[model samples]
Target chain A: MKAFDYARATDLSDAIGASGCLIAGGTNLLDLMKLEVETPSALVDITRIGLNEIVPEGDGLRIGALVTNAACAADPAVRRGWPLLSRAILAGASPQLRNKATTAGNLCQRTRCSYFMDNRSACNKRQPGSGCAAIGGINRNHAILGTSDACIATYPGDMAVALAALGAQVEIEGPGGTRHIPVADFHRLPGEDPSRDNVLEVGEVITAVLLPAPVEARQIYRKVRDRASYAFALVSVAAVLRMQDGAIAQAKLAFGGVAHKPWIDPRVDSLLVGETPSKALFDKAADLLLEGAEGQGGNDFKIPLARRTLAAVLAEATAE
Target chain B: MAQSPAARIAVNGVTYEFDGDVRRSLLDFLRRDLGLTGTKKGCDHGQCGACTVMVNGRRINSCLSLAVMHDGDEVTTIEGLGAADNLSALQKAFVSHDGFQCGYCTPGQICSAAAMMEEIREGWPSFASEDVAGRVHLDDEEIRERMSGNLCRCGAYANILTAIKEVMESGAKP
Candidate 1:
C-alpha cells in the first residue's frame, strides 16, 4: 500500500472534525488501498475516537459506526430486538472479519468491482467516464435490478440490506453538523452520475446508525448464492412481516445483490400487507419487484430465484 | 522500518504495545507483535477462517483488516483461550474430539467457536433457527450455520462440532 498520513482522532468531535480520509477498521479501506482503488493522501484513524459505544438514542439504539461486527451481533438489543440485523451480520464474511469490520466502514466500502480490482480495465466506479467493462464483459454477478447503462454494480454487505428493511437511520457528521439520514436513502442507484457512490457528502464522517425498536413482525433474511458461505449474495432478501392471527399486518422487503443500494421494495411489501402469508403473496411481490428488473444476460434467473427465496422465507416465517 | 503503531492496545485484559507495520494485518500483529502466534493466516483474502479472532468479543476476518485500526481495541486471540499450560474447556474438548487434520485452522476454529458460543449465549439466532420468539437453540443445523464461516479444508466439521457441543453440554461458563 502506498504511504498515507495516519492520524488518530480523540473524540467524535475531533474524529469527525479531522481532515483526510476517515478509516475505522481499515478492512475495506486497506483492501481498496492495496488495489489502488482508493488513494487518500492521509487517513484519519477514528477507531479510538470513542465512537464504538452502542447507546440509546431518541427512538432507537444509536450504534456507533465504529462498533465491531461481533459487538453488534452479541449486543442484547440487536440479538433480540433486531434479529434481521444480527442474522445478516452473521451471514456475512467470517468471525475474523466481523472483529475487524466496523458498521460505518462496511456501509461505505467501495463496490467489489472485479475489473476495477484488476485496475487495468474501464470501470466507471474506479475511474469516472472510463466506461463500464462489465456492461459487455462477464456480468454474471452484476446487478439485475436498478441498473443503468453506466454501471451495474451491486452493494455487497448483508447488514446494510437488513438495516434498510428495518428503517434504520444513518447519522453522519459533516461540515454542516450531525444529521440523521434514512438508511434507505443512504446509497444511490446508477443514474447518469455513477461517480457518486453514496449520499454522504465530502468531508462527512458517519457517526452512528439508528435502528428503531422492532415492529411485531417476522423477519427472515434469506440470501441465495453459489456457495454456502463467505461469498456475496446472488440475491438476498431482508424481510419483516407483522402477522395478526395468521394475517399479514405489515410487511417490509429489501433486496441485495440485485441493485446499487439495498433494494427496499415497499410496493411489494404493500402488495403483501393485507394478504395472507402464502406463495401467492410472495409471487405477487416477486412479480411486482422484478417488473423493474432489466436483466441483460444470465442474471435473468435471479427474477425467479428471488421469488423462490421470498416464498421460502415467508413459509419459514409463517411456520412459527 | 515503518513506525510501529504499537501503543497500549488493551487486548484481553492486559495492555500490550505491539510493534506492527501499518500494512500488516490485525492477524499478523496479534501473532507476531505480541508473540501470540496462535492466530493463523489461511488465505489472507478474508476467504478462510484461519486468522479468526475476537475484537470486543465479535468474530471477524483479521486478514482483511489492518492492525492500526485496532488501536486501544480489545482482542482475544486463540493464545488467550487457556494458554499452553492451561486450556479452555473448548480447547480441551477439541483435543478430546480430535478436531484437527493439519492443525492449521484449529486456532481460528477455536476462536470462532468461542465467539459463536458467546453469540449463542447472548440469544442471537442464526438462519437455521425456525423459531425466533423462544430461546434460540443451537442444534446441528444451527451449529453448521454459525460455524459455516470457519471452513476447514480437511473437512473436520463433524469433530469440530463435537468439541463445541462437549463444551456447551458441560454447562461451563454459566
Candidate 2:
C-alpha cells in the first residue's frame, strides 16, 4: 500500500477535513489500499469517536454507523426485532469479517466487479467514462435489473437489501447540513448517471443508520450463492410479510446481488395483500419483479434464478 | 517505505507506541512491530482468516485493519493464549489430535476459534440458528458454522473441531 498520513479525528467534521477518506474499521479500505484499488492522500481514523452504539430511539433503532457487523447482528434488539438484517449480516463473509466491518463502511464500500478488480480493465465506476467492460465482457454475476450502457456491476452485500426492506434511513453530515436519507433513496440506480452510486455529495460522512420501527411481519433473508459460506449471493431476497387469517396484510420484498439498489416490488407485494399466499401468488409476484430484468448473454440465467429466489422467500414468509 | 505512524496498542497486556504508516495493517504491527509473531497472514484479501485477532473481545481480520486505528483498545493475538510451559487446552488438544500441517495458519485459526466460543456463549447465532430469538445451542453444526471463517487449506478441519471440542469440554484457558 502507498504511504499516507493517519490520525484519529476527535469529531466527524474534523475527520472529513483531515483526510480524504474516513477509516471506520479499516476492513474494506485497507484491502483496497493494498491492492491499489483505493489510494487516499490521508486516512482519518474514526474508530475513537464512539459511533458504535446500537440503541432504541423512540420506536426504532439508532444504529451508529461505526457498529461492527458482529455487534449489530449479535445485539438483542436486532436478533429479535430485525432477524432479516441479522441473518443477512450473518450470511455475509464470515465471523472474522463481521467483527472488523462497520455498518457505515459496509454501505460505503465500492463495487466488486472483476473488471473493476483489475485496474487496467475499463470500468466506469473506477474511472468514469473509461467505458464499461462488464457490459460485453464475462458478466455471469453482472446486474440485470438496474443498469445502463455505462455500468452493469451489482451491489454485492446482503445486509443492505434487508435494510432497504425494513425501511432503514441513513444519517449523514455533509457541507449542506445533517440529512437523513431513506435507505431506498440513498443508493441510486444506474439510470443516466452511473458514476454516482450513493446520493451523498462530496465530503459527506455518514454518522448513523436509523432503522424504522420493525414491521409486525414474518421476515426472512433467503440467499442463494455458490459456496456454503463466505461468498457473495447470486440473487438474495429480503422478504417481510404480515399475514392476517391466510391473507397478506402487508409485504415488503427487496432483492440483492441483482440490481444497483434494493430491487423492491411493492406492486407485486400488493397483489399478496388480501389473498392466500400459495405457490401461484408468489410466482405471479416473482414474474412481476422480473419484468425489468434485461440480461446480458452470460447472465441470462439470473432472470429465472432471481424469480425463484423471490418466490422461495415469499413462500417462507407465509410459513410459520 | 514511508514514516511509521504513531498509536498506542495494548495486546495481551503489553502496551506499544510506534510511528507506523496509515496504510500499514494491524497484522503487520502485531507481527513486525510488537514481534507477536504467532498471528499469521494467509490471503491479504478478505477471503481467508489467517490474520485473525481480537480487538476489545471481538475477533476480526487483522489484515483488513490499519494498526494506528486501534488506540487505547485491548487486543489479543495467538501468543496471548498460552505458551510452551503452560499450554491452553485448545493448544494441547491440537498437539494431542495433530490439528495442523504446515502450521502457518495455526495462530489465526486458534485465535478465531477462541472468539467464536465466546460469541456462542452470548447467545449470538448464525443462519442455521433454530430459533432466531431463542437461546442458541452450540452443537457441531453451530461450531462448523461459526468457525467457517478460518480456513485450513491443508483440510485439517476434523482435527481442529476435535481440538475445540476438547477445550470446550475441559474448560481451560485455550
**Clash totals, every prediction:** 10, 5
* TM-score of model 1 (CA atoms): 0.87
Assess candidate 2 and give its TM-score to the true structure. 0.96
Where does the lowest 10-residue lDDT sum fall in candidate 2 chain A? A11-20
Predicted candidate 2 versus true structure: per-residue lDDT over A153-194, tens digit per residue: 888888888998898999998777889987877888877667
iRMSD per model? 4.4, 4.1
lDDT of 1 by residue, A1-320 (tens): 77777666766665655667877767777778877878888777776777788888765798988898867876777767888898888788765566678899889876775876778989887788899998878877888888888898888889999999999999988878878899999999988777787998877889889999778777878988887866789889888878787787878888888888899877887887777776766777778888878776867788778778878877777765
TM-score per candidate, chains pooled: 0.87, 0.96
> Once superposed on the true structure, which residue ranges of model 1 sit more than 4 Å away at CA?
A243-248, A275-282, A314-320, B1-6, B9-16, B30-37, B54-59, B73-96, B121-123, B131-134, B171-174
Kindly give the stretch of ten consecutive residues in candidate 1 chain A with the minimal lDDT sum: A10-19
lDDT (10s digit) by residue, model 1, range B27-71:
777777777778887877777788888877778778877777676
The parts of candidate 2 lying over 4 Å away from their true place are A16-19, B1-5
Candidate topping lDDT: 2
**Candidate 1: true contacts recovered, fraction:** 0.41
- Candidate 2 chain B weakest lDDT stretch, 10 residues: B1-10
